[model samples]
Target: MANVDQDSNLDGATEGSSNANAPLKRNSDDPGWNCGTLCDPLNKDAIKCKLCGFICKAGITRLKYHVSGLKGNGVAICKNASKEDKAVCVALLENPKEDKIAKRKREEEMRAEVEIEVEDNEFYAGSKKKRRSNLRPLDKFTNPINPEGPFLNMRQQNLLDALSKERTHSVHQFCARWMYESGVPFHSIDNDAFEKFVEAVGQYGRGYCPPSQYLLREPLLKEEVERTKGLLKKQEEESACNGCSVMIDGWTDRKRRSIMNFCVNSKEGTTFHSSIECSTDSHTGQFIFDYVDKCIEDVGAQNVIQVVTDNAANNLAAAKLLIEKRPNMFWTSCAAYTIDLMLEAIGKEGKFKEWIAKAKNLTIFIYAHHWTLALMRKFTKCKDIVRPGVTRFATTFLTLQSLMEKQEKLKTYVY
Candidate 1:
């Protein structure tokens, strides 16, 4: 009997040992188990990474860190893990609790929707009619349904509630001040792209950083160029359908380099074709003719209806050459330039020449002295004496007109 009892005790001990050595069964939904396997049956914390084949002594969290390729977590990252797998692990690590809460909320909402739909179907199928309320239809005027507007989701409502008039005004003032300080054009705020950019920034919420200078100059610039090309292509197609006018103009930049701009104008709009630097080449008829011919070729000679240029001798010669080559297209002088020449001739007259010289001297003197300028502004109520125009000669006449209009104020200030 003692031998049989000893045998039963040994059998129970062996069964208990086997149970202790059994592998732990983890939750099937755990993402950590997908990337690793149990290294030891008894030790639940020990896991072998399938990616790098490294055995980690820590728990599932450490195994996730390894799969996520995160450093400084007392575990080596999985070198063999792909970017997609690493991203999954990183997202899980960052917002595990938030993800769970969101999932639960979504499930509850779906269940509620299904219940409401079922109830609606049953109510519609039933023979009984809906009960009439005690309140009259006219009573709705006093107690309106959603007087503010339609109902919004919780997140949208929160965002709208947070954006008060005062906060919006403050943000506007801050942006305006930055643009003013940076010398950005005031009209830039009116651009559709600027409005969209502001909308995008607002949508991103807080903790969003602006693009770096390198991105702005390189990638963003290239993207903008490509977009502009697409828009110009549409314009070019329209121009091809309805012939375009080729306009050429030359100007000296701040660096004293002569630049010739070629533009194509159609019923759609004007598109800048190209710019050629002519600092090395003389302003000869042959040079102008060659440049204009090249531009016409690029724009498709068949699409060009007319060539327009200033009334300069070289431009006239170039126009003649263009007419000879392309008899179909006409050559015309710029009306604005012709008017500017007439204004220049009038300014050079004896009577007007002296008057303009005196006016120019007076303006120079008043602008040169801060005290005089301030006094003039104080007397004129901040009105300026100079009036800019399209051309230099036109500007002179406009300035004279402005001075005449403020003559009484000037007299008062001078006294």
Candidate 2:
């Protein structure tokens, strides 16, 4: 219930002097987090977990993981951390429904205060009250400004039906609650104490409070549907100016799934359209063509002037097929990918290949050894070696370019 300074390195935890070696005090809400037996001999700038006896660098995040029973980054989770603390920590790691309901309740209270207030009439004028006739039609009260604003959309209706709620669900309130509960100010979610704060009010609040995930599922779905509808509507409006071109990009996810994403580019601006999990079938020329055809049809065949994809055999086949079918709308490979391929090919030639290998080795050497990596950062003004891009060839080209730029500074450090 108490506020703590957010500026200190330890967020809600108690801040000590600026001495880098000093361990931050366990945050007020964090129960039973301390170093204990079997702690290895180490300098002051290291953390020793009391429950699991794991030692690591002195950082608040590591301490939090230990106290919250989160095992990550080579640190073992504390076995002795309270199950209550662990439960709250896990709930906030994902979206929780009770938090959303609480947030909506808070917004409603605030909005009630801000809106036009009506007070009871103090006195009536000294005049005889006229008898009222029931001749006025209540239908005349219908709003002329936004006649359809009061009704829910088909998506919202479907959402309510899925949830099996007795009546129609609210629209505006659902969206506000979704964002608030989802933690729109993203950095706050990283706080170890955020879950504690939410649970405190949720458990102690007056009246019946719904603390179930089922309550949130409907609202989250409705919000997502509305969000997609708004984006597509915006795209439709923008594309009216000059239509749009589609670009298809493919990548293999960690699970070995082939994913294809299609984006629209126009004078108005580039916008993402959709993605498809294409791992199911053989993505031959025919497979890629079928997906591209669907996108063209969705965006309007005549409106799409061009389709861009990589220069793979299957993609080339797809382009040929598209050209044969719709001659007016062109399909071609991406120019940037072509140039990146060239840079990669050039780097692989005879002596240049050796130079690229040495550059990679130097990067690996510094990164593998923490002390050297630190020294390298200090020398190069805190910039890491230019990271490799998604493609292997392109990655080599970029890292080589980066090393060349820092050649003089690296040489001085080496000597």
Candidate 3:
């Protein structure tokens, strides 16, 4: 502590203290600081305002303004002080000491709060600092903690810390699988509302940490494998020696990847057999024949009765090749494909094309605006227009039929 004599000088106050933890010497020039009364001088760094006999904490710089006749800093103006100091103080009532120390302290606290908010956001979005917590297996965490402890037996935070990398990764996989299967956008995790939800869980229900998409893929895949195996086992047990029919179809998905899907029907059940991505291979008769042959062999050719495929020329040729190899089973074209093709041929006639064109225009316009669609649904008691099916032939007739059914509602909505 620097000794302060009656003379007003701050030369000694600035010396002998380069350490940050050292008590700050009062700057005499500060609007709130000055000498105390002679009887109890220094006042252990308290501000002794003789005018109002007010004494406050040492660094309450605001008090200096009050003693100087200022009315800010949550203090009233003192009745005493020279007329000159009073004049200067009155103009500064709205603005008290803009002290660097107090400003810096407030700034630091604000920054800390901002940092906590950032961390919370990152956690909910399944993005976090790479720092490892010494978390143990959740098997241990399942046990209740000692109620007598200050907090829960194992602090939720300790549990968070205890999580091993593997367990954390599994949790991440769980979250990812949930979103992917539900068709949620991958970036939804980064939304502010999502962050608030995770933060709420942490604050109220116990801390929750979300997992990432990549983390979820592995576990969900394993689960899918097990689930498929279970289904296959059940089907095998239920199936009798009765003949089974296999149906196969080839198409490109929205992603433009070629896929071949197979299904089997029997006394057991109609079950999806498998799907193969054949993007790289040509969809020729030979390719289709080989796959059909493999399917028959795998399901036991002795129990196979027939095979079905769409009426594509390639599919028809492939079926012929398949039957030649295994004369035990017959190949058939799908009735649904035949119906769709017949409808398409009818729609292609010039007389029908006029009506189809008009229907297509109306559907295109109605679907373009969500509000218009909603209005149409309301008038029709909330039934949406039939969505276009995969095949143009089917889609056209289906939509036309729907338009015909809702003709009155469509007229009402149009006007």
**Which candidate gets the maximum lDDT versus the true structure?**
1
Q: Could you give the candidate ranking by TM-score, starting with the highest?
A: 1, 2, 3
lDDT of 2 by residue, 345-403 (tens): 89879899899888888888899999999999898779877676867788887888888
The residue-level lDDT of candidate 3 at 348 comes to 87
C-alpha lDDT values of all predictions = 0.77, 0.64, 0.65
Q: Kindly report which residue stretches of model 1 are placed more than 4 angstroms away from their true locations once superposed.
A: 1-163, 173-186
Q: Which tens-of-lDDT digit does each residue in 329-394 have in candidate 3? A: 888888888888889889989999999998878877877988888888888778877757868788
Residue pairs with backbone overlap in model 3: 32-64, 134-162, 135-161, 135-162, 135-163, 136-162, 145-153, 172-211, 173-215, 173-216
Whole-structure CA lDDT of model 3: 0.65
Name the runs in model 2 displaced over 4 angstroms: 1-216, 378-382
- Per-prediction backbone clash count: 0, 0, 10
Structural similarity to truth (TM-score) of each candidate: 0.58, 0.48, 0.46
Which 10 consecutive positions of candidate 2 have the poorest summed lDDT? Answer: 152-161
Model 3 per-residue lDDT at 78: 68
User: Compared with the true structure, what per-residue lDDT tens digits does model 1 show for residues 133-181?
Assistant: 2333333223222313432211111122243565445456667887999
